[model samples]
Structure formats: C-alpha cells, structure tokens
Target: MSQSPPARKPIIEFRGVSKSFGTQRILDGLDLKVHYGEALVIVGPSGTGKSTILRLMCGLLEPDSGEVLLGGLPLQAEQLQRKPIQVGMVFQQAALFDSLTVEENVGFLLYEHSKLPRTKIGELVREKLEMVGLDPVLARQMPAELSGGQRKRVSFARAIMEDPTVPDDETQLLLYDEPTAGLDPIASTVIENLIRSLKQRGSCDSYVVITHQETTIRSTADRILLIYQGKVRWEGQAPEIDACQDPYVRQFFDGKIDGPIQ
Candidate 1:
C-alpha cells in the first residue's frame, strides 16, 4: 500500500518575502525557514537587507509582495496583534529607556503585560539581570551610567525577562539586530558567549542573529546565510563558510575588496 505524505513542521517560515524602500529593493524574493532550536545567522554587507529580515519577522515591516508566516500563520495588517507568541528581540543600541531605572526597564513588559503586582515584577526583573551575570544592585542604576557592554547585557536581560526562559523553548524565537555592532573586542566576546549560552537554555527555542563581525559570526552561528544584493546567495554551516564556492560569500568571508560583490 502507498504511504501518505509526510507532515511539515515549522516554527517560522518566510515565503518569497520581498521588500523595497521608495524605488530601491532591499529584499528580493527572500525565502527562509527557521526551525525550532536552530541558530541561524544572517551575514552580508552593510546595505544587504539584513535588518529588514528581523523587522519582517516581528511584523514591524511587511513584504511588498510576499508573506511572513509565524507558527504556520500569516501575519496580516490587523493580525499584527502584539501578542507574545513566544518571541523576544534585542536591538544593537540597547534601546533602553534612558529615563527609566534598570529594574524598571527590565520589568517594562512584565509590568505592562502581566496582572502581577509591581513587587513581583521587580523581583522577576532582578532575577533576570542576575542570570545575565549582572548584579541585582545594578537594577537601580540608569542606562547612561552603564558602559556600552553593560547596557547591551542589561537590554539582553530585559529581552529575556519577558521571556521567563533563557535558552528554552517557551518562546519560539529570539531576534537579534546587530547584537555586536559597536563594541570593543572584549565586550563583543562577552555578547557572543551570551548568545551561545542562550542556545543551551532550550532545545525548542531558535534564534536569528544579524551581525557583521567575523568573530561574532563565527562563534554564535550554527548555520550561515549570506545575503548579497537583496538576495540570499548561499547558506551552510559556519565552519564550511570559508570553503564556500560563491564569490560573494568568499569575498565577504576573506574580507576582499574586489569581487563580484562590489
């Protein structure tokens, strides 16, 4: 007897997603699939539409022609409900409220979303900060007073505070936008190590990290997807990146000046 077709399981799927600004296209027919518990790193030149991907995932931006499906569900205009479907985001700038204290910032989501008392949220916030290797005493400090790395780490703590799970699958995804963009070598390494640890938290939680640093790229990524000229030219394991045959991937990986990319 003939067997039935196998079922398809996907935590997130981008189908022919394309985006444009004014007249210029940023993403063209970009199709990507992110499974649960997979760490996918997207690397490319400055204007290669890397950030667009994250925006699309969060419904902050929509594809001009295609669609973004979360948990097999398409995100429409009204369907863009800010419901916490187990997703968290960490922006490069730390994007914390300078006016708010660290504890308040970390508890922002919990305070607003949960019916829990402020004291409970505050306790949870402090716990989250400590989990990121920061002292709970830093909670009363302001963002401006912290160093760049500390600020980023604090923001990461905030991102996960709403999560209630670090490396776990309570959330389907964690979107990182240039998580290591403007830091010194040591700070960058710290962030990279945090990314690795996040993966260990759960077997069902996956990540999409947008970065340009080679070390950041090499350390956190299990798979690499190269976006060139608004298109994904190639993809594979991080260790296999140097051996990739695509000129765009090769030029970027080897830090070359002259290639088909330029």
Candidate 2:
C-alpha cells in the first residue's frame, strides 16, 4: 500500500495563545491554525477578541502568553520585516491615509520601502487598481472623494500589492477585520465577491476573515470557527453551521437571546 501524503504545516498557527488588556482578558489559551489556500471565517459577539486575533496574526500586537507562528516560525517584529511570506491586513474601516490619493495609498509600501522608480510603481498601482475593479484614472483621486465600496476596493488593492523585484516578499496571508461591516447589502455582496475572486486569482495563499454578517460568512468561508469567552467553542464547514447544535454556534448564528453565549 502507498503511504499517506505528509501533513502540510499551517501558514499561521496560534499555540495556547492568551492576551489581556489592563483588567480584562481577551484571549485565553486559544489555539488555531490556518492552512494554505484556506478561507477561514471567525464569528463571535462584539468585544470578544475577534479584532485582537487579527492584530496578533499581523504582529501589531503580541500575545501576553503563548506563541504566534508565521510560516512555521515564531512571529517577531524583525522577522516580519524579512519574512518570505508576507501578511497584509484590511481594517474594518478601510484605513486608507486620508492625505494620500488612491494611487499613493495603494503603492505606499513600495514608495516607502523599495528603490523602484516612480513610473514603475505607478504602473503596478494601476494594474492592482484595475484588478480590484477600479478604473486606473481613480488613482489620482483622494480617499475622501471615493464612496464606501470604492474605499474598500482601494484598500484591497493596497493589501495585495507586492514588489515584483522581491520574489520572496509575496503576500501569502491576508487578515480582514470586519470587511463588510458598514456596507449596504449590494455593496456587501460586491466586497464578498472580491474576497473570493482574490483568492481564486492566487493573490494570496490563504486568508482569515473576522465578520458577523451571515451572508459574508456563507460567501467566503471554507471553514467556520466560533469564538466564545476567548476560546474556540465550535468548528464546522459553512453548510454545517445551520445544523450545528453547539450552544454558542446556535445562539450566535440564530441571533437567539438565550443560550450559553450569554
């Protein structure tokens, strides 16, 4: 008989991770993994450390205890600077610099870090803009001039921008924190489709999305993780969510007022 193929290591892993802020605890002994090419969605009640998890994964906030590994190595600020697998984040509010034009914002990383000429950076910026369904001409417009959906698309373009010269500096993982929070249903659907299209286009190897919108969860997740009281309380595929009997899963997804979640 042929031997089973070796298990693939996770692109991102949290081992017994815990975090606290002043007097309140956020994460407690939480363990999680994001495999390559996976679209993982995390859903939970507000203020339950969902955003905190995204911050930890991107090295903005270190865990109070336990380890966060990226590409199977411990996540460190210095390592993030040179890590072969890059990680990018799209904040809930589409945190574009208000002072910069769309082109400037999308190409900020290259402008600040690389020695590439301005014309080359401009070409890459327009390419990414078009990829995200934005007209290249919009590159000259400021962030304040764009609508909510446009702003989100600009942020997406920014997140996926990579330097072609640095072959090792590819963005392999993207963390989205409540990407569709304030959009209307139609706009939300657009963002949702973009999320799927980005992955299918091989822009990133994997992504972790933190969202509460039922439609978003259904549209993007390959697997679902429900966090309650700082730990994973349930896990299942998108289709399994409706049939799951776990109190936290039912309470959160069904919008019920009474359950273990309270």
Candidate 3:
C-alpha cells in the first residue's frame, strides 16, 4: 500500500470570522487558512477587506465573531504588542517614521527592547538593508531622502529583523499589505523578485500578501484567494487562476469593467 503524504499545517487559521465597522461589514463568516512554507496572495477590488485580513492575522484587529488561531490557540489582539507571536508586517505605505534615520527605523524594535549594544544593532541594520538590495550607506539617510521603492525595501528590511523577545522559530509568518503598489514597472519587478528571493532563502516559513497588481499576483503567489463582498469568492493554485470559471474570478483575471466586482 502507498503511504499518503502528511497534511499541510497552517500557522494561522481564521475560523468563521466576521468583522464590521459600524454598519459596514468587512469580512463575513470567513474561513481561511495560511499554511507553512507557502505564499498566499489575496486580491480583490478596493475595500473588499484585503487589508483587513492581514490585520486579523497579525492581531491588529479582532473579529466581531469567531476566532483567529495560531497553532490552534486563539490569538488575542493584545498579544501582538507583546511580540509573543513574532509577526512581521510591511505596511501599505511603508509606514516609516519621518524622524528616524533608515538605520534607526530598521533597528527600532531592537534598540528599544533588546539589550544588544548599539554597534551590534547597527551591523544587523546594515545586513538587513543589504539583504533588501539596498546600499548600507542609505542607513544614515532619512525616509524623505529615499525614493518610493527604496522606502518599501527599507520597510522589508525592518520586518525581517529578529525580535529578541520572541524565539527564532516563532518568527515564521510575514504579512505584506500592498507591497508593490504605486511603483514603476521596474520597481514592481524588484518587489516581485524580492518576494521570490525571500521564499527561496526561507526567510519566513509562510507569507500572506495583499496586493492588486497583476504582476505581483502572478509572481508572489503559490496560491491565490479572491475576496469579494465580504467573502472568499474563489481560491486555487497560481497556475489554475487563469482557468477558473467563477464569474468573479474571470472578471478579476481579465480586468473586466462590467462584473459583480462593481
């Protein structure tokens, strides 16, 4: 008899989750799973709760109903600030502090919370910057001194930095919100390649990316999920995306103007 392969394990699970802001429901009775060693890219029209999904997973937001779980344990929103789960986030706008230098920004958590010496923190900062394909010299510069792409890269560097409080194995989930948005083709390609390279390097065991860019969707996703009207409209492997016949999936893949999306 042939043995079956082991089941894939999810680092995080959204079980019957629902979220609403006043009367506007964002996610409704959603069930989603983010597994280990995979890239799951989420795509949808504006305000379809793409970013909200990221927030829920990273514990920035709590669902009005159901639970977000880590290793089958429910995650509380307050746990995020304690760095207990070791999640890294690349925000939509990069979210750099204008007052801090690149080095300071990348090393902010370590500088504030870790007892590591300043010289050592600076070295780690340089290493992360270089890993992101940025010059270490940029570390001395401010956010305003960099281009949009550079800022995004710096944000990535910051996300990958180790939090001393969290165990090394705990830092396996990476969440990106609109990582490639508002960039030129070359810049977008850079972000795409970076995502692939990070996967290749095993920088994180799993990544969840929220993006609207087609190139990003094609390049970064091992699997794809389409959210529409507070639900998962479709989901499949990246290559299967084009052949999916669901009307919403078809409309999104073809960039159609007249569809249920609107």
Candidate 4:
C-alpha cells in the first residue's frame, strides 16, 4: 500500500499576483510565501510595492490578477466569514485617534464589536499596554499628550487587544508596515525589541514585517526577501543578508552609492 503525502500547513501565500494603478504597475507576477511560525521581513527601496503586499495579504486591497491566500484558502469575503483568521496590523504611522484616550483607543475594537463591559475591556487594554513595555499611567493620556514612540506603542497595544480566545494552534498573524518608521534611534530600538519578543507571547504564530531600516531588518527578520520592480530580487535567511551576491541585494544592504539599484 502507498502512503499518503505529507500535508501542507496553512500560511499566507501570494500566487503570481499583479496590481496596477491607472498606468503604473505596482506588482507584476509576484509570488511569495510566508510560512507559519516564522518572522518574514520584506525590504526594498520606496515605491517597490512592499506596503501593497501587506494590504493585499490582509484583504485591504485586491490584486488585479492572481490570488492571495490565507491559511491555504483564497481570501474571499465569503470564506473570511466562514473561517475567520485573527490578524493584527501595525501601520507605518501610529494611527491613533486624537480624541480618544490611550486606554479607549486600545480597547476600541472590543468596545464596539463585543459585549464585554468597559471595565473588563479596560483591564485587557492595560494588559496589552504592559506587553508593549508601556506604563499603565499612560492609558489615561490622549494621543497628543504622548511622544512619537508612545503613540506607536499604543498602536501596537490596540492591534493585539482584539483576540484573546484563539488557541496556540490557531494563533494570530501580525503584520507590521514599517513599525519603526520616523522615530528616533532609541524609539526605533524600542519597537525592534518589542518585535524580537513576539515569539514569547505564544499567541502569535507568524509575522510579516515590511521595513527598509537596516537595524530593523537585521534584528527582526528570520528570513528576508528583497523586492524590486514588483519582483522578489533576492531571498535569504537573516544571517545571509550581508553575504548575498545579488547586485540589488548588495547595493541595498551595503549602502553603496553605486550599484544596479539605481
């Protein structure tokens, strides 16, 4: 008797995806896969469709051609309703509401979507805040009252607050779209360390981080994929970035003024 084939695990996959805006093509026949329980970092120059990939992954935008699959299934509206996957996304800028206090902002999804009492949600809010290495006192402050780093940290807390019931096998997938962009070196380090600590949380199965920062790339990536002209120019493990021989990868990682990138 013949044995059955090994089963393929569920994870995010992009199959020959292509997208265009008016006349400019953002992604062209791009194929990528993000494996479960791995930190996949996508890095490239600006305007190379890095952010677009995240949007497509989360169903914020649809590709003009090809498929975006989440958990071995197409990310269609109907499929999403039948079997929802927990996803947490952190935007480039800390997109917090100016009017709401930090606690309110963190618990906004819970407050609106669930029947949980405000006090209970507040407690959960404080929990997430602590996870991000933030003070509980900062919860009462408005967005305007906090510094850039504080705002970004609050955003992280909010993204993670919605799902508390998923089991270890059904862990949430986190996506970071330039989580440390436009912050001071110290503040950037804070976010990088937070990303580094994600595996310990046990609730997150995998993550996809899109960033161009060298430090963030080095510290957060388990595997790195370099995208250029809407295609994956180079791919390797984190330790292999410096040793990559591709001209585009060399130029980008080495910070050379002259190479094939231009």
User: Model 1: what TM-score?
Assistant: 0.90
For every model shown, what is its TM-score relative to the native structure? 0.90, 0.96, 0.93, 0.93
- Best of the two (1, 4) by TM-score: 4
Clashing pairs in 2: none
**Candidates' lDDT values, in order?**
0.82, 0.93, 0.88, 0.86
Residue 110's lDDT within candidate 4 is 85
List candidate 4 stretches off by more than 4 Å: 1-7, 77-79, 163-169
- Candidate 1 lDDT: 0.82
> Clashing residue pairs, candidate 4?
none
Question: Which wins on lDDT, candidate 1 or candidate 2?
Answer: 2
Backbone atom clashes (below 3 Å) for every candidate: 4, 0, 0, 0
Per-residue lDDT of model 1, residues 1-262, tens digit only: 9999866556678888889999989998889988866889999998889988998887788889887888778866325654335667898798999999999899998776778788878888888887777999999999999999999989888877653433333455888999988999998999998887866864127889999999988998888899987888888888887677788878988889999787
Candidate 2 structure quality by residue, lDDT tens digits, 86-135:
88899999999999999999999999999999999999999999999999
Error of 3 at 224 (Å): 0.3
In terms of lDDT, the poorest run of 10 residues in model 2 is: 77-86
Minimal lDDT window, size 10, model 4: 162-171
